[model samples]
Target chain A: MAAVDWGTTRLRVWLVDEAGNVLAERRGDDGLITAQAAGFSTILEGHLAAMGAPEAMPVIVCGMAGSRQGWLEAPYVTVPAPIGAILAGAARVPGQRRDIRIVPGLAQRQADAPDVMRGEETQLAGAGLPAKGRHLVCMPGTHSKWVLVEDSAVTGFGTWPTGELFSVLAAHSILRHSLGEQPQPVASGNPFFQRWCEQALAEGGDVTSRLFSIRAAGLLQDLKPGDAAACLSGLLIGGEIASASRRYGKGGSVVLVASGALSTLYTEALGLAGLAVRAVDADEAVRAGLIEAARKNGMIAGSGVAA
Target chain B: MAAVDWGTTRLRVWLVDEAGNVLAERRGDDGLITAQAAGFSTILEGHLAAMGAPEAMPVIVCGMAGSRQGWLEAPYVTVPAPIGAILAGAARVPGQRRDIRIVPGLAQRQADAPDVMRGEETQLAGAGLPAKGRHLVCMPGTHSKWVLVEDSAVTGFGTWPTGELFSVLAAHSILRHSLGEQPQPVASGNPFFQRWCEQALAEGGDVTSRLFSIRAAGLLQDLKPGDAAACLSGLLIGGEIASASRRYGKGGSVVLVASGALSTLYTEALGLAGLAVRAVDADEAVRAGLIEAARKNGMIAGSGVAA
Candidate 1:
């Protein structure tokens, strides 16, 4: 069996043995945006061939590939929904050479606070839902998701455009003058980043006002470009945590599903925000989720009965 | 005499008679950013000549023209300081054909909440500081200033990057997909705008999270381009007002120093937030500010003592 996490800008695939051990893996730039124009089936076949996967191997997919503009629309499953239900509601690609199932995303249709998530749902499932007590999950990315899980069900969730906002402001806004043209990675241990995180957490609600302080600090206090970049990251991540904590209720421990640089930054920020976080590798979680979905759909042999 | 508002992206010069009445006006794209390389003196001279001003006319300039990168660094007048003191601290351009004075901006030097504003001080001086009472002034622009004025002095203020955020998000972020290429002015009475404004005011502090909803709403509810644009505007403005009101204390009536479309949008949003707003034309206020600065500096004859 094979698993794939296909998003807007990147694609990751893994070939797994019957016991769910990863035998091989491959990554590509052929995300939904690129693959949509140049055939999804072709892209998937090429990637599978590159990984040397068998032609009859069953594949499980997640993320934007199931979006309306992708190969086929996998309509959103509304919350308070069980994570396992996503696998049960998976949409299979029609007229395919092999069995390919795409996990459905989640939607919060509350009129006042409507939100949707594509790839993060799989991350949540892979993180393992809390069985007895409620849990708060923070998945940081281009669109960060704050999920509330109670007794293995996702009660509600919110999305924060922190990453996107930071990118756009750092590149396009006047703050770009302070933050140089090149995208510099903010160091998690930078004091400037820590100070800004504390400041943002303290001034929780006034993000817009605090954002201007970056420029003011740059202009008036001679804040260095690298520090400015770190400050920006801290402020955005800290503010997201503050707001998410408030909105979702900060009662339980937060499960942070992330990887690489983002994971480090978010872990530091959550710690600064004074929350205990259980870290999970996002890549592994997504793959585990795909494997679980495949097993539930009977595309792969498993003893578990439809989750 | 002439009054000039030389900002980063625009230049506006108004020829005024001794009685403080505008005789002629000229506007150009050569702001401090553009004029810095093009020669500030040459640009000013051309505008003055276009407005048919006399060679000996003393010009009172405000805004970015006073920045370090401007004609000459006017330096910052620290607060809690009187607005009229700006005239006294003005930086004069030496070795020029005409007497050109640039009013200094105000800076809050506090290490925790450092903030700075250039042109708005002149507007405050022109608007005539509240006599024997406290006033909250909202100057909406690229960097909107929410100033707290008491007994003719600016005690403290905050800057919200609402306008810049809106522009960047509308033009560069994922929201741009729904908002089209050309920026559309949000209608004040748009229901989507009003609803989002009310929601933002209610939610108040979660701007980053709410921003993502704009994209989600567009995706799930099929929100149109115009409505999406309006919704974005409402969320930003409402969030700004909410945070500003909280930080500045929502006791006094808000003095909305804005003009045209922004004024209308702000006024309506403020009204929705259940705050009484005293609308002051921003153009007239800035002009009056420049005129007052000129008079106080003894460049023009006036009987009125500096407020």
Candidate 2:
């Protein structure tokens, strides 16, 4: 069986043996845009062939490939949708010789706060959350999602444009002058980052009033561009944590599904807000999710079930 | 007498008679950058000459011209310094034929929330708030400043980058796709704007969580580009109001120093937040401020004072 995470800008695939051990792996920029232009079948099959994958190995796909503009629209399964329902709701790509199923994303259609997520749902399914009780899951990205799950069902979630806001403000806003062209990396331990994060949390996530202070600090105190960048990162991330905490309550540990730099930042921010972090690698979670979808869709045999 | 508002990217000069009536006006792109290249004296003299003003007429300048990088560094008068200090601290631009002065800006150097304002201090002086009470002055612009005035002294102020945030998000963020290249103007009566503003206020200015919903709503509900732009505006303005209210308490009517489209939008948002707005035209306020600076510096005689 082959598991593929086909997002908007990147694609990754892994071949697994019957025992669930990885046999081969491939990654590329052949995401939705490339696949749409080159043809999804051409791209997928080419990658499979290059990895020397078996001709009959069915593929379990997720992410933007399931979006309306992608290869085939895997219509969203609205929440409080059961975890198993998502795996079962896989939309099979028609006319393909091999069984190719794309996992459906989740949609919250609340009138006031309509939201939809494609790839992150697969990551959620693979996060291996507890079967019972309420859990708060934090998935930080360009658009971060704070999801609430109860009894293995997604109850509700909120999305924050923290990452995108930071990008735009740094690159395009007046703060650009203070931040310089390319800002230095902001580590979790950066004092400026921690302090600003704490301040945002203390102020109940009201950061707009404090943003201009960064530029002023640069002008008046000669604050370094690197520190200014760190302050921004802290303010945004801190604001996100504060809002999510208020919306969903600071309940125990947050299942932080992220990797690398973002992971470090969020972990630090969450801890500052008095929330413990249960870290999970995003890549592993998505792959596990695809594998689960494959098994549930009967493309692969469950461990205790007969093939 | 000549009053000049020399900001970062714009320069405006008003020729005023002894009676404080404008005789003529000249506006140009001779701001800090241009003035730096083509000597400030030359730019001022050229504008003055074009206005047919007397060669010996004294000039009173404000805004970025007072900054260290400007023509003459009119060092910031630290708060809670009285309005009189700012007027008296005017830095004289030496080596000029005329007695040219630049009004000093106000600086809040509290290590935790350091802030500075150049042109706005003049506006505050001209706003004509009650001399005894603690007044909250809301000046909306690219970097919107909410100032606290007690007696004739500026206690403190905070700057919210509301306009700049809206501009960058519309032009550079993923929301740009939903908002279009050029969104229709968002008026005060836009329902989408009102609703989002109300929501942000209710949520205690926690708008970071709601930011992505604008993008999601566009994807799911086929929200119009104009409505999307309105939603962004509402969220930012609403958040600013909410935060400022928390920081400075929703006291009596807020002194709203703004004009044009911004004045309309802010007036509506402030009403939604249940605060009365004492509307003041920004142009008139700044001009009045410059006049006040001129009178205090004796470049122009006070109505009651001897020449």
**Per-prediction TM-score to the true structure, in the order listed:** 0.97, 0.96
Mark the regions of model 1 whose C-alpha exceeds 4 Å error after superposition: A304-307, B303-307
lDDT of 1 by residue, A1-307 (tens): 9899999989999999878899999999999999989999999999999889899998889999999999889999998898777777889899998989898999888877889999888888788765768888899998889988888889999998889888999999988988988858987699988998888787654578788788888878999889889988888888888888778775457899999999999989889887888999999889888888888788888844455
Record all residue pairs in model 2 with backbone atoms less than 3 Å apart, i.e. clashing. none
In terms of TM-score, which candidate is strongest? Answer: 1
For all predictions in the order shown, the interface RMSD in Å is: 1.3, 1.0
lDDT of 2 by residue, A1-307 (tens): 9999999889999998766688889999989988889999999999999999888889999999988889999999888888777777899999999999999888899989899889898899889899998889999988999899999889998898888888888999988988889987797599999999999998777888889899889877889999999999999899988888888886488999999999999898899999988999998899888888888888888832112
Q: What shift in Å separates residue B18 of candidate 2 from its native position after superposition?
A: 1.4
Task: Write down the lDDT of every candidate, Cα atoms only.
Answer: 0.86, 0.88
Native-structure RMSD, model 2: 2.1
Candidate 1 has a DockQ of 0.76
